[model samples]
Target: MTLDVDEIERLYAYPATERPWVRTNFVSTLDGAATGTDGRSGTLGGDTDTRVFALLRSLSDVIVVGAGTARDEAYADYEVDTDLRGRLGLSPIPAMALISRRLDIPQHLLVADNLVVTTADADPARLATLRESVEVIAVGDGEIDWPDVLTIFADRGWTRVLCEGGPSLHGELVAHDLVDELCLTIAPILAAGGAPRISHGAHTVDQQMRLAHAIEADGGLLTRWVRDRDR
Candidate 1:
């Protein structure tokens, strides 16, 4: 079924209150992908998928992205809809959270309520510099601890999080059993050589997910899955 704006909005809106977290992970084909491999995801999906993506971002309290994705996509803070915020019982804008092992971030890219999650052993100077621009959070015991990171977000009242990933980070989350839901958009075109596949994580068939739903968007397939409870 082709997704429409009302359906997209309703899907996101319903999940915001029922689910604690929702992660949207996607990858594009070769031959200059995701908006022509020049590196933009704007053209990757159709109008419906685009609206769905925007709604997903809008309903999230925090948009969690890997540092690599942030750099490659030239990420920026999304303007929040006050009406949506009131409906979801959220503040004006959602926080933009970046997960980076190093402190190598550009000062100009810092958003007003941006956050950097790094290891406790990260360079002091880098931490200080980031503090000058946005919130700097140190989690784990000198490593990027996933458990600690979740606890940190939980402590900060971020129950609903949207992780827009770039493979490696998604693999890490999958490996750690941290992902509760997966929303994948599969384009009709294939990139047999250029970009990597949707997931590179190591998992047995027992780790397979159960399909919750699927929709046709922009001639491609958008599938949602939930981890098998029996697994």
Candidate 2:
């Protein structure tokens, strides 16, 4: 099926109770992918794709992205259309979350309700800065604790967390069995090498997900899947 912008928007607009936690993951071809050969995801995806992506962001209560993704994507403020928020049954804006060992976040990307999950052993000064900018939560004893991180979000009323990944984060989430749903956007073009693949985790075929749906968008494909419960 072709998942146009309207359909994608409707998918997100469905009641949160129907789809509590949705994680959207995407990876473009290598060789400066996501953009044309230039290097921007917006360029590669058409208008419909962009609209779908934006709607997904709007519907999510919290948008989780790795530090590398934030830096690479040059992440900016998340703005949702006033009318769209009502349509999607969402808050005015979704909180931005960054998972990193250190507290090296850009000032401009900082929002009112930013969340930083780091290790207890991180630099004290950096922790102070992060706390001043947004809500800082110390998770694990080491660099970062996955379980603690999840607990922190759970405490913050994030019942339906949306993770937007850059591979490494996706690997960690999948490894810890923290992901409930996976929404992947697969672009048609293939580049030889500049970025990593969709997932970096070490999972056998049996451990992989079963497709829930496969929909074409632009020239690419968007695949949604749910993890095997028995696994």
Candidate 3:
């Protein structure tokens, strides 16, 4: 079945507020592999996944992602629909935020408008070089503090935060119990052997999620979930 754009928008809608909200979106194989043999999650998505992905992007105020994922995905500047922006009451086109500990980011992604969330102890010279172009926010001294990430977003009035991940970031968010919603696309394929799950980490955090809804299309399944806050 085909999912209508309006229907999909309504399904993924966030509350109309300037409060910090985090939504992590990912596509994985049926066998729980986030990446295929190609070592990238892009291979796991199909046409419907692309539509839903764009829909989610149009709905968000800013796109937050890990630097590794940004590099691997070859992220570029994006133009959002002005009509959608007006309809959603979004202040601007979705801004891109990259969270990095190592500070090894793609030069192309260092566009002036983008935000780079990093730590204080990161390479000062490199950071100084990047400061010439992009806006950099330092959260912690050694590692990225997720709480500070939220604060920065809130201060910027970026209530709608969409995280398109490389799993490690998702894992960190999940560990901190900060993720509010998860949108997962289950592709109908088994990528067996040595592949990571949607969230990867040595530590474990068991968070229950309520299945808000699931839509099947293009031989794949897209599921929306909200954290079971009451649990």
Best by TM-score: 3
Clashing pairs in 2: 34-40, 35-40
TM-score of each: 0.85, 0.83, 0.95
Cα lDDT of model 1 by residue, 1-231, tens digit: 766656766655534333345465563543324433454565576676666677777777788888887887777646656787787688777787788888776666575678888888888888887887788788776568877777777777787788888666777787777777787766676544455454555663235777877777677777777765422
**Candidate 3 similarity to native, TM-score:** 0.95
Candidate 1: worst 10 consecutive residues by lDDT?
Answer: 27-36
lDDT of 2 by residue, 66-158 (tens): 887788788987677657667756667778888787677777766667787778888889888777768877766764786666666667666
Off by over 4 Å in 2: 1-6, 12-22, 30-36, 87-89, 201-206
User: Local error of candidate 1 at 228, Å?
Assistant: 4.2
lDDT tens string, model 3, 105-157? 89888887788999988889988988888999887877788888788788978
Q: Higher TM-score: candidate 2 or 3?
A: 3
Q: Count the backbone clashes (under 3 Å) in each candidate.
A: 2, 2, 0
Candidate 1's error at 171, in angstroms? 1.3
TM-score of 2: 0.83
Q: Largest lDDT belongs to which candidate? A: 3
Each model's lDDT: 0.70, 0.68, 0.86
